[model samples]
Target: MMALVGPVGPVGIDQLGVYVPEYVLPLDQLAAARGVPVEKLHIGIGAQQMAVAPPWEDAVTLGANAAARAIAQGHISPDEIGLLLVATETGVDHAKPASIFLHELLGVTANCRTLELKHACYSGTAGVMIAADWIRSGAARGRKALVVATDIARYDLHSSAEFTQGAGAVAVVVSEQPRLLALDPISGVFASNVYDFWRPLDRREALVDGKFSVDCYLNALDGAVADYRNGHSTPSGALSEEFAALLYHTPFPKMAYKAHLRLIEGEWRAAGRNPADLGPAAEQSYRTLVEPTLGAARVVGNTYTASLYLCLAWLAEQQGRALEGRSLGLFSYGSGCCAEFFSGQCVAGSAKVAAGIGVADLLAARRTLTVDEYEAFGRDGAGADLPVESRANFCRFAGVREDKRLYERTGSLAQ
Candidate 1:
């Protein structure tokens, strides 16, 4: 079916805000507490740090922070946001959209259609694309929409997935003629494979055939990129070797590395040349952009769908370098399998993008516990589900007791 390709609608992200909890968790500390080899937490995975949010800050608070920060940075107004879409896997309620929480907590206008989208990590892009289409439809009429990606990943204690778990949120406002990064509508996606990964509600961690996941990712990546490149007759093909940078979802540092390598290998083979003969050019590009981005990912553990979005955020924050006015190829892969290959044109607004929280501050904020302590900390079970306290960070369910949750700021206001 031919979807409406609009009247040159210039839709893109207007502003971006980030929310990270004040707490930090050091992998070295985790090793110290677990009695595991320090290298396992260090060089092996190369993870130096992670963010740990208090029970009070769930997906909603994290999302709110990003949204508020975007506003604080002077981008859009609450009145301009006609739609609120929260794309997250770790939702507070299945029946109700978590977007409602942000709307109520932030006191968004009543007319906004608050909703949540779930499709693994692709949900964020889904939200953005939908907003883009809305703008293309002329339905926005200058109004904007809020798209938030917030997640808390926990893979149980001592599980493979555990090392990749991270908590944070990325909020972006989408509108017509954004001054920041301009998103190109051209995208390639692949659906219909469920064998790679999953985490059911009954289970706390995910079950992933690491190798299988990698294969699925590579296949989707190549197919989507090739199709897009072939369909559009652009210079050197978007999937060709020339682009500003390539960014990926770093579930575990090595995971994306393998996929990146596979891309190069396939490219060499397609040209009917020995991969070794391609020299360091191809390898270097992937190594420079893909590697460090994945390395930074190690500290985060896995954010399920939010992982790739954070990788992009991390890239935009690094200083003294230049990426403005360049095109970045992005591969966003989600388990239970969904993937997207798209490109984002980096504009001149990185000064704003840099304002987001950095790796150093986030890692520094965490409070480490012994592995036993971590197990105990996680086991603590949202801390005393009391109903009378006021919690400043207020989690999704259960009010604060005595100033903890029961006493949280209510929308009705006090008498």
Candidate 2:
């Protein structure tokens, strides 16, 4: 990993775009199907709905769609992108990097550097940091880099993680003069070798030590935040006073809320203040600074590598004009595990860029699926019985043939 030093100028997100699949599985339906109370899913798990990709949709299609949207929204020519990095855990191929497919799909220049990154959910933030460093180092002078986080979170049927399963992608364009959040080059990271979550090579879904995973998540957050504050000489109240919002890599909203509480209590204790005395105030601050960032993730569930960026897009879209000049604290974590605490300041006119992405419209336009329908969709992995031909105009995963993964692209370039 490259060292993170302060950049000479603002270098961060120039444009952003997100793609959630058209299908949605409501939590109420999931609870009903699982023979549980609706509140168990809605309140207990902190997920309201989950975005579900069809048999024909996977990381590649979702990523390509998001990248295309970012390129179009930024008015960036494909040839102007010098680096294309994809962060994903649910890659379609074991040996081939997903960014190679994305590069060809998006029509990026032949000279572009392309690769895929994996560190569980933290890979996306890693991609963003690397792209920013690449530009700041003047290696890609005058050219923009595309960083994408795409994933599908899946577990075995009727499992605790089932409610958290979701699929989506977020694409960001990075350049010197950013239209969205301008990143601080200095970041704090904490990594440890722990197996809270993992998937064996032969398994299709992840095996998680649920309680252990939660513990690791909170511990990682504490370590990262402490390191960040100490490295920067930040005071205890800096988190509560300086940052307008706090975003987390959410597997679910309730987990993020717990992490926020831990952060607040940690800050108070480190400052020699009684955490018990600050309970009500801390809760209020968490609601104010963190709740807004969860709106989208609550609806989309856990998107693995895409989770943190999804929170960022949600915050940008929800706060809009009010976000200008305000700083944001972001926490990125991957299970096995790596965590980073970083900050970014919203540049002027960031609201315009956020509004251009049309996330609200996309969510509104999604098709809600009944529990039976969702189950059926999940079972039909090969998409042989479905009318995939109707989706030919868009990028889709055509069924595998002769043990080879196939993709269909009707148009020359993604619209």
Candidate 3:
């Protein structure tokens, strides 16, 4: 990993795009089917629905769909993208990087550099930071980099993590003079050899120690935030007071809320104030600073590597013009476990660009699935019976043949 130092100029996300599967399994429906209380899913984990990808949609397809939207939204030509970095844990092939498929699907030039990054959920943040560094180093030579975080979160049926299953992708075009958020060059980072969560190659679903993962997450946040504050010596007020809002790597919506609470407790402890005395003020702060970021995640569930960026998309879509010139604190965490705390400022005209993205509209348009239908999707021999809708210009996985995985776009890229 490259050391994060101050950049020469502002370099960050120029445009953002997101793609969620059209199908969703409502948590209430899943809860009823499993004989679990609905509140445990709705209020406990703070998830309402989980997006479900059809068999034809893999990480590559989902990522391509998002990258296409971003390219269109940014008015970027394929030749202008000098680098393409894809972040995902749910990769389709063991040897080929997912970026190669995305490059073909998105019609990028052969000159572009492509790579795949994996660090559980933290890979997206790593991609963004690396892209920014590449621009600062003059490696892109005035060309932009496209970073896409895409994943399908799957778990064994009837397992503890079943309700968190979801599929989605988030893409951002990174360049100088960005129209969206401008990232601060310095980032606080931490890593450890803890195995709180992991997926072995033989298994299709991930194994997690839920309670241990939560503890690891909180510890990583503490370490990252401390390193961040060390670099930023603010005399005005508490470090938390410097940001308009805070966003965290959300495996689920409630996890973000917990991350915010941890920040509050850390600040209070540093000031020799009893964290128990935080009272209603901490709750109010969370409502003001964090609630908006969770709206999309509550509906989409855990997107793994896409999870953190998904929060940023939701915030930009919801807050719009209100975010102009304000600073935002962001934290990213990946289990096994790596973490980072960083800051970015909402650029001017961000609202206008954000308004054009249509993230909220995409969420509103999803179709709900019956519990039986959701279960059947995981069964073998179900793929042939599934109908593949031809979404214009969207890529779909056309089953493997002769050890070669096939892909096709529904509509022409030239169109």
Candidate 4:
């Protein structure tokens, strides 16, 4: 419950960029292939489609494309970026940091600091917080920080977690007087030693206790929101009354809905009302404050580290001008497990910045893959070391040679 002490001035996300692979798998196809009811996937988990990365497209490539898109769309010069923070659960190498690869691919200057952060799905928020703090501390030296949250969520092909798998990246530029979302330096955090979800060094797919993870997520949400209410003082209203929208780290879209209900129930109890009678009320509140954030996530599945930011992007895109000047509450949860609740507000030019990133265009561009074709492609990065022709993507994972991961600039934003 310790406060994140700082100047707490106007420093936050200046621009946002996103990248999803061109390939997509509709969850109905997967449900049918698995002999499961499609409604269970569509209604139970709230997933429709998921982005599928080819073997050659790993975290490094996905992150690089996203960062490049940010630089290009935001009209930011790579030399002006002083720090590069990449957050991912899927790491390509044991020794090397993915940020270094992104630095080279995005043409960042030699003077930049590069590193990677991992804490399941929450590392992306960690990077953003660190970047904002760096700017606040004057450590950035008038240069912006680029925080890239990139991941390929993988699970056993025929397992229960399979429909939740997706791949994507979200890149944000943090700096002074940001044009997109202006972040508050204060944050509420919670952590515990729990193994609700984890992946070992030897395995490509993650292990998750579905029911336990849901419980953990709800508990962490409670802890984080309580801490947030304690430390926050500037916004002079109740949590539900102060914020225009709420976003959560979405492993799947339904998980977010559950978190909202948990928050609403807590609010109901605190107001001396019956929590059991708040179901319809909670659903209505969720529709107004949280549902807009899930459009991209419903289609993309679990983006792991990029999940929360993906929601922000979706919200900005869906609400457009309506979001300007409105404040938002965001909760980030990662299992093994840590959680944080933070605040941000949409700035004057938020709509333009969001539109420039073109989130809708990215989702509309994906090519649907057949279930058999997806299975043939596999979850492991099998043909990653082989050479292939460059496509219209901004960059690609070319091949690995002599124990080095190689990448190439295939095209530009215009293509």
Candidate 5:
């Protein structure tokens, strides 16, 4: 659409697609009933809203929606799509790659390379990294790569982290010499110790220490930032004071706030700079984002792999073109204690790319579920059938006779 201001690179997110189901669990309501101030959950996890997925929305359905929209908008033909990737711990099948289902729903070419990746929340970024390399290699014969990061964040009912649960997806299309901002060749990544979150196949909820997870986020955030700063040369004119917008891996919105403020504090103290010297714009930008982050994310909770990208979607909506053409800082952290620090330029098309979602309409269209409905939805998986509310047609349950997977086609490939 002539919106991309610069030459594209192999690694940049050319088009981004986001999908959050209509149903949401508002945090203030939860807090009021829990007999505490809204700030309790609000301040505790930095989440104000969390989106819950009923049976109708699964990783397959949500990821398909996001990926389909991105590809269609980018004018990519299904025949030219060589890689179909679905990265999530909440994958549809333990044995089968979720990409197969995506292929069926999106009508990707039969010759595609389909694979499912798992590395906690980092799986999505991992998919992007590898797909970039694949595109750069050009061995796929003019084919582009499509990666969908989808997940549902669930903790056992009544767990402290339970309120942070969310479901969503972010789709990215990577191609060679494309339309979008170019990615920098250099990036920073680090793997710290692991202890925060993990769940086995049999378990439905996540297990973790909230303090430990928060501690990991702060340490990883600082660690990655320090690594990037130490190795890279800064840009001229306010390298110390200037940055476009800082987006962090939002396990929850409040957690990101705590980490962001801590980063600002450390940055100011290290430079002997007055925090207020930067003026209200910088502070307000960060505040406007992180303050309502918890509230905004409380309803959607944590979408795991899609968490950070989902934050980018929110930032695009609120920040507008002010962030365009500027350097955007990002921190991505995963549960296994993996973290990466990178920067992306906000090209002219940033807002336009983010403008495709019908978030308000989707929110209005969802069917809200009570605690009982949520429990039923959460518990309906395994060698069994999907719950009554499921609307996943492409992979509908057909009562397992043995251990083999059987899929029922719902519709044509929409990719």
Candidate 6:
């Protein structure tokens, strides 16, 4: 348990921007390609569609685009950001941090301290906490921080985890007097060395122990939630009823569903109620408090570090003004493995800021790829050599050549 020491001034997300690639793979198409029933993916796993990044998009490009959107939408001058951190598992360079490229592409001040954070998926939340603390502790001297979570979840073809692959990025601006959710200073974190999921340096895709991963995720959720309750001095009964919404990292929607069941069951058990008898009540509570948070993950699949923030973005956009002053509980988990439980209060007008990000339109405008096309794209690195028209106002991965990664900025530089 770690709590802010100084007078915690209001510091939280001031703006959020998301960039989902322009390609999508429908779960039905994937099911047919894998010779499996569509219901397995559609209902069992709860994945509807997934975003696919073209060759021109990687973690760096996605992060840069997302950060650009955040800066533009928030009307934040690049010079105002003193720290820029990127969280990712699929970084472009092994030696150079992804934030270095993003810093140049976004045109942040040269004086900014930029780095990459990695802890599987939990790195994003870690970056958020670091930024908030930096501001709260006066290290930032009123300057803001930019934290971007960007990743492309890739799995070996025909692997069990294939259907869960997706790509996207979310950029959040943190500063005092946040327009979005105001974060609490205290957070509950639990970490353990677990090998449920991982990728070695030589492997291009992840290797996962599916069953063990699920168990780890659930156990981490339970532990973090318990720590959170104990730290806040709130008993299980009150903890369950206090939150207006609960958000969690969604590798797939079904995982989140199971976690919600655990949470509801635990609460009931603590209150001396029969968990079996509260089935209908639990379902209703999940539908009301948890289901809404999965909307984006259902469509975009697992975005690694961006997973939870994407859910928060979706909630903010969908719930809009109605979420004002409501308390939101968030659980973040990363493989090999760390988990944190935290809470935030939705500020007034936060919904409008979320809605302004235009994530829905971005998803709607995507081009769907057939199974064969998708496989071919994956085979040739998504046509990395093919020439594509460059948008005038976007950041893109130009290409890699001679073992050097190149990035291009065609848009107006951040001021």
For TM-score, candidate 4 versus 5, the one ahead is: 4
Please provide, for model 4 over 141-174, each residue's C-alpha lDDT reduced to its tens digit, 9 standing for 90 to 100.
Answer: 6899999999999898899999999999999999
Task: List runs of model 1 lying over 4 Å from the truth.
Answer: 1-9, 32-36, 40-44, 234-240, 276-279, 292-296, 319-321, 349-373, 383-415
Question: Candidate 1 at residue 283, lDDT?
Answer: 62
What's the TM-score of every candidate structure? 0.85, 0.95, 0.96, 0.95, 0.84, 0.96
Residue-level error in angstroms, candidate 5, position 240? 7.4
- Return the TM-score for candidate 4, rounded to 2 decimals: 0.95
Give the per-residue lDDT of model 1 (tens digit) for 1-415: 8665557456787776666665557777776655678777566655666666556557776787666666656445677888899988877655867788778765678988789988777788788888887877777766888899888776667765566567878887888777556787888777766777776777655667767877887787777667656556542332535556678766666667666777777676776778787678666866776765664476666665567767776776663047777777788777667777777777776555555535445445455645564565476655634334432332334555454332233322111
Candidate 3 lDDT (Cα, whole model)? 0.88
lDDT against the true structure, per candidate, is 0.68, 0.86, 0.88, 0.88, 0.69, 0.88
Candidate 6 backbone collisions, by pair: none
Candidate 2 residue lDDT tens string, 194-260: 9999988888789999999999999999889888887788746558777999998899899888888
Clashes of each: 25, 0, 0, 0, 22, 0
Higher-scoring candidate on TM-score, 5 or 6: 6
Q: List model 3 lDDT by residue over 240-287, tens digit each.
A: 688888999999999988989999988888888999999998999899
TM-score, prediction 3: 0.96
lDDT of 6 by residue, 48-80 (tens): 998887777789988888898888888889989
Residue-level lDDT for 72 in candidate 1: 52
